[model samples]
Target: MPQIFRIVPYSIYFWSNESDPLEPIHVHISEGRATSNATKIWITSTGKTVIKVLGENPG
Candidate 1:
């Protein structure tokens, strides 16, 4: 995964595998590099972000 940005306790990124033609544009958020516990947010064609999954620590 390549990190897009970071803000304190959270890191925003996207996996390189996302380049697959079947995948939509989206982002993954996690505490540090624990991607197994990350949350997924899908960027809709309408330019909105929809939470696809909640992280282990939703706080």
Candidate 2:
């Protein structure tokens, strides 16, 4: 996972596995490296972060 940046308690990142292709630009937000409990956000071309899905323990 490549970390893009961090904001307070949330650490944003994305996986670099080429085996599974991820369409469109998106990011995973989680506290620490707990990706399973993170939220998924889709990035729009207009520079907007849209919430795609909320994790089981989303903050």
Candidate 3:
């Protein structure tokens, strides 16, 4: 399950596919792609993004 929001310019914000639809999993946000240097965030059930795991380290 992916949740996308309409945001402003230069903001590549979009929820990619979930790791598993059946499982909520750890509720932690991770990089959608292992090889991707992209940033990810943990989201609530209400589709609100939490600032829990922002692994935006310089590559």
Candidate 4:
């Protein structure tokens, strides 16, 4: 399981367990319920957007 950092109103923050699997390490961002619709991004190489959805419209 992943570890949560902070959860703001706009976004939810989480630590990556995929640093070894995917270099640069990353955090998970979710908007609504479930992490399915969340966007995964690289913490080191952010701003370019490398998001991968866990699912579709999990609202």
Top candidate when judged by TM-score against the true structure? 1
Taken over the whole model, the C-alpha lDDT of each candidate is 0.75, 0.73, 0.40, 0.55
What C-alpha lDDT, on a 0 to 100 scale, does residue 21 get in candidate 2?
A: 59
Q: Rank the candidates by lDDT, best first.
A: 1, 2, 4, 3
The model with the greatest lDDT is 1
**Cα-based lDDT at residue 17, candidate 1:** 65
Worst 10 residues of 1 by lDDT: 50-59
Q: Write the per-residue lDDT of candidate 1 for residues 1-59, one digit (tens) a residue.
A: 67899987888988776544756877888876646557888898999888866547454
> Looking at candidate 1, what is the lDDT of residue 33?
67
Q: Residue 3's C-alpha lDDT in candidate 4?
A: 43
Task: Show pairs that collide, candidate 1.
Answer: none
Root-mean-square deviation of each candidate, in angstroms? 3.1, 2.9, 6.5, 4.2
lDDT of 2 by residue, 1-59 (tens): 88899887878888765235555787788876646547778788999878865656545
Error of 2 at 21 (Å): 4.8
Model 3, span 1-59: residue lDDT tens: 23243243213344346455542322332333232334455556887765543455332
Better of 1 and 3 by lDDT: 1
Worst 10 residues of 4 by lDDT: 1-10
lDDT of predicted model 1: 0.75
Error of 2 at 17 (Å): 3.8
Better of 2 and 4 by lDDT: 2
Candidate 3 local lDDT, residue 5: 39
Steric collisions counted per model: 0, 0, 0, 0
